[model samples]
Target: MKPALLLLLLAFTAFQLALCDRNFPSIFTGEMSDFNIETISKANSIRREYAKKNNVANMNKLTMSFHLITIAQRLAPECEKVRPGSIYRYVLLKPDAAAAAHEENLKLYLDYTYARNRPLWNERVRSMEQDTAYHLEFLVAEQRQIGCTFANCTRTVRDEQTLEYTTINYGALCLLGPERLFQGDRPKWYAFDEKKGDPGSACLQGLVNDDGLCVLPPPQRGVTRIPKPTYIPPSTAPPGTAPTKLETDEINDFFLFNELRRNWARNNGVSNMWRVEPDYDLRLKAQKLAAEDCEKVWPTENYRYFMRHTDKTNKEVAAATHEIFKTKIDTILHEWDRKEFENAIFRLEELDRDTASVMEFLIAEQRDFGCASASCARTVLNPKTLEYQTIEYENLCLFGPSGKLMANPPYNYSRTLPPFNQKYGELASDCGPDGIKEPKEDGGVLCVRKIPRISIEPRKPVAQALVMIEPKMEMIQITAVSEHSLNWRLVAILVCLAIMN
Candidate 1:
């Protein structure tokens, strides 16, 4: 053989060997085994190898997230129908189920490849880098929590040689999460300085070196775990105050808005979404404007606003005002979720800028806000019939002192600097000075901001008095007009009697 040809052949063989180092006796079959531990361990080993090769510090060991496991289970059914296309397309089809997952990797082997002994699970995990460098969930240093599962499936394909259809069995291994990493045209690797620090000195907070791999230290004994309640009722009116239904609703809205923002920030690459407290002044102003009618965007010089409209029934309006304000708020949020705003980046300068999209609610500078809702029946002239009709409308408005809904700036000051920029998952090291690392109920840690005490007083009763007096004055005028007519009639009768005498 020619020397050049032999060298090329050797290089190709080496590449194939790197792609699959270990071979299995047969295809994956039978019921799935509990490979969660093995999967996580092997994945971390690969991560450590990559880090060492790149001269970067090893990231924290990947832990299994049940949240991602549930998502993996959902995808397990689709493995049978897997085709040669983007795996993310399948995930995008079910946005709600997969919203929390940041990335997915799937390794599939058909009958043709099965003839040449399939690769073992660990080998597949190791080959992830060689298989597709862009979708390297295992190699990406930012991803820390993972959920993996295997599926065996069979499908019918036409044999090209025989020109006949044949049934073939296939096996697939799937992995999901660490959540916050956004997969784009190119992979976003963990930022690090090459060969600048000691082997383990580059490890972030909440992580330590476990041998060569960065890992979370074992939980200390005797530590108390706080029991999280499933549900907490909204606050009610104090003793003699008139219902305070609006106040209760505002309180509930404040909590829901902050919770949604926190969840999004934690799952995205955002690090500085401060806890939004209820501002009484903002709430009163929003409520007053909403009550007038929810027709168009109400832009104020000092505040940003998000408004939503829904068709509602009289019963819904009454119920919302008296008892189910939280339900109404939930419905409005659901409407926003249905829009799937997280799927893309939208700028405030987009063609349709009047209405605020989900991006508005996610502005990092939005520190405090208030929400208000109003329901009314509007009379509109039907375009076709030229007849006036009453239409029921429900409007929800959220306003804050800051939080402009512009495009995300190119640089984020909140994100941690190099060597410690991994912000999501179990070993997140990006909590700022006032933030506390708190474990999420599902899995992973969140940098919870320490909210300072706001000394603003409760909403003054002036606005409430103004709302009350309008109706009362109308009632008083109606009574006065009736009494004046009655008095005039009595005087006319007395005048007639005097003329007759």
Candidate 2:
């Protein structure tokens, strides 16, 4: 296929979606129980589907392919070239490393037309982060005049004489003053008006003497100076009062981190910092009365037993006295998650025992069968010791060493092996080429071989034998019977059943 069946890039590249299954944690039961695990779980499976759709890697490859096709069309403008509105299939390929691999890279197939296509380079090249450079959005935002409007602020202009920005005092902001005299205001000079000179024209008006010489008017005396206003602007705080602090915008604390941390911090009431320092400063001196609470409670150590009380009245009063607050940080989730996670370190028992099994719909399970070159999850249960096993993931893709399938490729999953059918044992085991599919030329992990038959010490049918049945039993490798031998095996099974009856 020139243009292969196209699987687009995934949505959330970093999302590690856990397998959705009924195998939930023990605490979750049903709706009638204390909590309905289903409510939270509904969001999980959705993540899987959403993420695959946004897969960055796939998107990058597709973009490369589209660009290539576009370039081809532009280059070969003659004839039909490529149809304008046709959909083409595509598959992502690993980038070629040896070539220029920059704009010169081309490993994807061009799909200018719906049905006609060819490998991008036929032999050309390929290329990770969609872009290498980090372009700060904040810088771009800074370059824009987003905050101030021309109505409230004057446009900055350069001074003609100095070739620098003219200084603006904005005295026009005063209700009593004339407009700030910008360059628009012209100073007009007038001829001597000896008879009755304009009092306001001190700079322009002049006098004529007997010699007919233009004598500038003598400097006027008693020019009254305007004193500074005692009244402050309403926007400024009064001299006697302190300015209030700026608060962060009240977006929803639906962020949950603060609440979750605070929940973890409280015991019936006292704050940990107050418990330790007794004199912790909360900077509420103006609003609240200062008290030496820590000194008073230190001797008695009352906070130790405060959490033991079950009554609401005592807790409420304690909360009023010892309000707790975590030191806020700047980053989004990383720091908050770290501090909250620390709550689990000291008190594992209080950790949420119930996991919301909401991911069930978001997952795709091979269901006792999966094909991959590697496993994200490798579960091992200890039957003798009865130990718990950590759940692992199913690798959507994997790599083998030196251009070969991995030693333990995902083409390996637990499957049942047929009883050694002497005449058809090989067929039943699916050890032949016909049994399992191979990797396509385009590339996909396929079943290579089933694990060899496991041997156990022969024992009498009635005797208890150590039967090791898994990682193979009910598991799939290259394990299944051929069609030709399947009928014979079925007949043999029928004969054995008849004899038993």
Candidate 3:
């Protein structure tokens, strides 16, 4: 049967059943749970009815048969084929290997995708940061140009080159004229009145030239030469005024690393940085301070921590700090060791129970049955069985070797000469060619048939036993009746009753 058609019928039947059971008008009812049950039940009913009509069993068996038939029809002779042995091999061995190989393949694809995206994504983020900085600089420049200042300045030099005698000593205006002209302020330049032959044509207005030059319109001269504003490198800020370039760089580096750690935490929780050992406690504590004020401090602490652990200049202390940080972070992520801890805790308990069960099996009784010819054993196939006998204590064995481990290929059970084969005795009939039948001396009982066996070493030793007991009471009842003797007994009973009457 076509799988698609089969699936369709199943779905329809499930829909009908759900509609009937739930009293729903249709499978497409508004109630989601009802709709789901209706659909599922209908599909199952249809599949069940179809299977009944076709003598198919459960869905899994049906699916397997369906796949096998499809494969048989579709594949050329050279193509791989599935057989019973192949099925067994796949179940026993190949599936685990295949799953592992598939997992590795998936990881390879994922890694490839990750590697492909990383550089492009990183460059994009970097470009965005640069763009942000440019916009900030533009905003700051606009603020400075519009007379945004706080105080006054001084001018150390103020005399016109043309009017050499007129010296406008505007005290400090040249240096501290306005907050807008503070040391870090933007320098504004203008085209000189080159039409007037001013050699130093364009310059930052208000600055004092060597000969005390002045602005074109001469707003003020004091701000120009406030002692040349003492070449205060940005580094020369007052003791605690602000961060220096070196400090800023260190702080930024720390923030970048911290941000990387935070992102990894967001993406995979602690899992991503399981190997990274940063001082999360210190970072978090400092972070609690308002970022407007504490951002600098936090970054400083992180930089210090990074230096203590990662610096090669202090090898011994660096190694020790690294180990300390590793231990601290490992403790924080203790959940990662859940599997290891669980295995350690439960190891002995499981071993004890398994050993006890093996010992009980070793002490149990075993019996023998009958025998068969080598050819019959070689040619016939054994039915799967569930019978298990406790052979030796810890050295016990299953009736069938592999399957007996759970139960698979039927074991050789006909061993002893008895009134009936022990296996047949247990089953109440020797399975015959037609079905099941009584055991006979000619060894014609069909149940005793054996097939070729592949032997493997048992995990434990198998024990043989010699034992005898009365046949089970149920066996007596079943074995006592023969067709010929049953009729004779009826006849004799009738004659005796007639004579008495």
How does each model score on lDDT? 0.40, 0.17, 0.22
lDDT of 3 by residue, 23-141 (tens): 32321234423333333233234433433343332121011111112222222132222111111111000112232233233333334544687664334333322111111111111
Residue 242, model 1: Cα distance from true site in angstroms? 8.2
The positional error of residue 271 in candidate 3, measured at the CA in angstroms, is 16
Model 3 misplaced stretches (Cα beyond 4 Å)? 1-243, 269-317, 331-501
1 against 2, candidate with superior TM-score: 1
Rank order by TM-score, top first?
1, 3, 2
Model 2 — TM-score against the truth? 0.13
Best by lDDT: 1
Question: Model 2 over residues 363-462: C-alpha lDDT tens digits?
Answer: 1110111111112222334333455343332212111111110112222111111111111111122224422322233111122223322222211221
Give the C-alpha lDDT of model 2. Answer: 0.17
Instruction: Choose 1 or 3, whichever is better by lDDT.
Output: 1
lDDT tens per residue, model 1, 208-238: 7765555544433332121231222222334
lDDT for 499 in candidate 2 is 19
